[model samples]
Target: MILIGRTPYATCQTAANVKALRTKLFTTDGYEPRVRPIDDQSLPIAITVDLYLLAINDLSEVSETLKTTAFLGLEWEDAFLRWTPASYNKTEYAFWPQVEMVGGSKGIIMDYYEANSGWDIIDSSWSVDTETGDSTINFSIRLRRKPLYFMLSVIFPIIALAILNLCAFLLPNECGERAGYAITVFLAFAVFLTIVSSSLPQNSESVSLVAIFLIIQTTCSTLITILVLALLRLGSFDEKDEKVAVPRVLTFLMRKLKWKSRSKCSKVETEKDGKMHDSQSSLPDASESKVSRIEMPTQLHENRLFKEASTVDEFSWKEVVVFLDVVLFVIFAIILTTSLLGCLVGAQRNAVN
Candidate 1:
């Protein structure tokens, strides 16, 4: 008897019987409790317990409804009694009946203890007849939850941050948007991680899901930052007279895709030279020698390759689309590969465990 809390018992034991019962109970009784070992992984922990709710009833034939007796005693594991709730009617209560554990033929039995320190009941009022048999309540116990908050706090943020990262694909490439967008999303993930860490307890464990998400997001942001800088340096190739050095990989691929295009300067020069040749050939006293000289210069500049190179100021829509499609596919490949690797690692570890 350790007193869990201050709640008095309303016992039904008679004076003489209660005194004798206590002497017999505390001196003779010895029973021990143990767990029911279960090997199945799917099954949750199961507990079977016999509980007694002590009550008093008058000798009169008419019986009343069940009433709460304040005194509660827990004879088994003290830890279980303190944690489990014993709810009845509309209100919840603790098991504080006026009883004690005594060894029986099969297992433990509840015995009537001393008279509760309370007012005596009327003659018509029933005091529960404890002299004949033990009055007990039985129940089966199990846990409902296993620290769900700890698990959810780790899982939800990771999923949320991963979805947020997908926003990068929708952002337009021009206007120097990709770098800023990556930085903003990265910072947002950092803020979410800060909130997640505040909720979780500090403990020794593998990296949590939220931490993994933040790290991945940061890595993506760094990669995007590098790509944005590279693209900025690539610039508008059409604007400069100097030959743009394409990437070795792209140059190899582009050699097969390159096509002729006419620039404005070459087209203007060609039209002017054509008019001069026509005027020269139309001259009434035109010498054949002078005609050949005039025709050679115009013919050289009028060729398809020379004129096409000078006139094209912009890339065709089809080429632009193809370039973008390839770049986006590469990005998608990286994300898919990383996700598959994570899944593979998780699965392998699970199998090993």
Candidate 2:
């Protein structure tokens, strides 16, 4: 018998035998015919058979390779019969000229191509046991995958959503859209992740690289959303609340950013100077001092009103929010860019290998 071709079913770990030919030999008893023309002589017979075969599927490199192995064998008993290489020749059973992979046409086409490995009769051998007369022929076919559809459909979209999440920081926090944008991008990432998860095999032993990348993207999106919320909280202060104190750390950061609130300090200094002037005037004429003190109280009261107005204008947390937004945006952009570049480079390297 000769093994000629096969079609592999990747998802099912099975294949359909494309072509096989069996040979049969017959012997004539003692009787002989009187005469026979060459055209009338019996010839060797050949028959073709197709059968379903179980195969081993290796998905370790799902993104790179879809390796499958099919086996063909016959069992023999020592007491009954023993098989060997051709009795007249030294060589073992020979393979057909080629084992065509006719099944490639039936395989899934998700932007990946059948890699160069193709159909190879990698391990062809006939093993025989003298004691038991057990015999077997085994051959394997290896298929490699080249992934393009997955990158385009799954990976690229996830990366784009991640980038969009990073860009949410560019929206001004006062507009109240930064958090919304981050949440929307996070939801988009979740949708992509669900799509990818549903497409991949459920019982894979290891995570796909694309899945890992999507997970990282989702994490970044979630963190960006949290950051937006935190910024909103940091900037949440009632304009009517006079006693809302800014944190010392935030105050320090504002100073570093050159956002100084000098109106309150200046107001305090002016009040101190007015007190000193009134005290000094009291050391002089009583009537003039009393008149000066009365006028001084009115001036101090007017100064307090002016100081309150200036304080309201100068003490807002808007600068802190803007600085936080800008800083976080830069950090997130760097992280996202590095992650995307690394993933691309890694994928290319895996494909090459």
* Each candidate's clash count: 23, 0
Ten-residue region with minimum lDDT total, candidate 1: 82-91
lDDT agreement with native, every candidate: 0.48, 0.60
Q: Evaluated with TM-score, which candidate comes out highest?
A: 2
Cα RMSD, model 1: 20.9
List runs of model 1 lying over 4 Å from the truth: 1-170, 200-205, 236-243, 255-293, 301-325, 340-353
* lDDT score for residue 72 of model 2: 49
Candidate 1, residues 148-248: lDDT per residue as tens digits? Answer: 56347655555555555555644555557766776776787677767776664445476544456456665765565565545544544424575454444
Return the TM-score for candidate 2, rounded to 2 decimals.
0.51
Q: How do the residues 50-141 of candidate 2 rate in per-residue lDDT, one tens digit apiece? A: 44355656655558865655554543222211223333233323333323332233233335634354232222233222232222223333
Cα lDDT for residue 119, model 2? 39
